[model samples]
Target: MEQSLYLKTAISAVRAAEKIIRRYWDDGFDVRLKADESPVTEADIEAERAIRQVIQEQFPSHGFYGEEMGSIRRDAEYSWLIDPIDGTKSFIRRTPFFSTQVALMKGNQIILGVSNAPLYGEMAWAEKGHGAFMNGHPVRVGKVTTLNNAALSLGNIKTLAQGTGWQGLGKIVSGVNRTRGYGDFCHYHMLAAGQVDLVIESDLNILDVAALSVIVEEAGGVITSLDGRQLGLEAKNVLAAATPELHELAREYLRVN
Candidate 1:
């Protein structure tokens, strides 16, 4: 299949999973914990199945890696990475912050991504060089330009404190225009939509951020680790910003106290 066809297939698949997810939005069935203590529910499995079926039927030669299932790789040049419900704990608790994230990667680099927040009724998608869109409307990065005017957002702050300590975040909040904690990748969505300027994440799996890298980059932003390394499945400690200045400031905070 062509890149466009596979991308369309991915968008359709995420939306289809969204439908199944919305069906149990109010109440999920029998939540459980993964070995990492993260929440999972029947809804997660159903959504993954829905997405996997789409990929398998339409892009049989492509590889797949998803949260609910193990990885499958083929000799094909493209792979689809998926997260049926990125915030399952929140979803199980009836929060609307959860999303279905999908990314198409080739040669170790993501070229396309789509994120669907069904309950929120919005979808953000991007293709290499084509730009990003939210609900089909074009989206771009914000241009706060300075730390004093920058909006700083975060997810899993408590976990961040456990890993590197909140002192870094403390400095960031004091230096930024505003600081808010939305507690999931939704902040990244807000970043892609140009609502927020900076987002620092700590301790996430690839499923949490695979699609986000493509969306933010396409939206004219940057996503690197706190240490200034490029974001990859191996690096979940994300430090994302709407502009280069904010990224540098955030990186300095991470490097300092």
Candidate 2:
């Protein structure tokens, strides 16, 4: 079945969500924490609502796994993975790290994705069988062959350490060149866009990793769990890289640590 139509809908959802986020961008919103201790604000709710509205209007039969609203039509093979506002804490602080992520998944595979970070004025998108692009220009992963020369992106070392212990986190950290923190799902886009070489994070919702997976893979990278497993709807940990060799090197450590 042709899915180009879904691409248009995915793009629209991201753009609509971007506008919603931009409105709340420096305006003060009541900030609070979710049950999982993650930040949530009005921007997140409005962005998700805007994106969901478009998705429902355009593809009512499609499924959605969203951060704020939970799951709907989830049994469908083709579904959307959405994180309306990825960096809620950053958005709350009026920092420039938050972004909106939308991904289309067919069964276990991600076919297309778009991530818009209004604060950074960037958009990364890709469709399966076609190359990835950034702001309409084709983007490719870097030539960082060796882990020692590769740059890395990570979120919350504290979580990694607490969940897997320092031995696990240390093995993975020491194997890379340098690690920089990026927004929730933006790190994967950076990998696909060649802005970063590697990213590993723990405790992510499906809405956080799904759409970003296609962006990375289309940019010539691999997106998998830290243990080298295939991406899953219920997955919570991820480590993506520009090359499979680097991915395995990191995955090995995380697995046995």
Candidate 3:
């Protein structure tokens, strides 16, 4: 299939998920804990199921790896990654920052990504070579070249401490002009839209970071782990920045070698 086909399919799949999410929004849904202690909701399961139904219909032979449903046809050359609700905590709290995330990976490399903030009425997407866009308008990472002028967004302190530790996070915070805990997929969208200059987080799975990886990269930013390594599904500690120079500077504070 063509690259555009991948992107279109991703968008359609997420929008299908968006419908289910919006239907359950503020209507009261049950939350259950996964084996890892992460929260899961009816919306998460149904939305992922909704996405799978759409994608599988079009590409029956493709693989699927979803947060709720796990994997199907895992050995297929083409795969779909789904995080039905990127911020389920926020979703359960009725916050509009939560999003639906979907991505297409061909042989381990993400080729398309779609992130839909349905409640906020915003959608961001990108293909491998195509540029990133928000609600059909092109977006790019900010031009902040120095940490002194950059606005940094960090993930939850507990998760950050798990990887880089408090001292390392302190070094990163002190070096930046501003810092905010815009946790989850919100900060990644902000980075892609040039609203924020950097974002660092830890303990991410492929479903958490895959879509944002392509979106941020296509927006002319770099997305990777704190160690400055290229991102793959296995990357846990993520560091996304507007420029290579800023990324290296942030890595220095992160103390990742």
lDDT of 1 by residue, 163-198 (tens): 564777788888888888875668888999899999
lDDT of 3 by residue, 75-147 (tens): 8999998999998989988888888999888997888899999887889998988899999899999999898
Better of 1 and 2 by lDDT: 1
- A best-first ranking of the candidates according to their lDDT comes to 3, 1, 2
Task: Provide the clash count, candidate 3.
Answer: 0
The segments of candidate 1 whose C-alpha lies over 4 angstroms from its true place after superposition are 1-3, 26-28, 74-76, 163-165
Q: Model 3, which residues run further than 4 Å from truth?
A: 1-3, 162-165
Candidate 3 overall Cα lDDT vs. reference? 0.87
lDDT of 3 at 111: 87
Which candidate number maximizes lDDT?
3
Clashes of each: 0, 0, 0
Residue 130 shift from truth in candidate 3, angstroms: 0.5
RMSD to native, candidate 3:
1.9
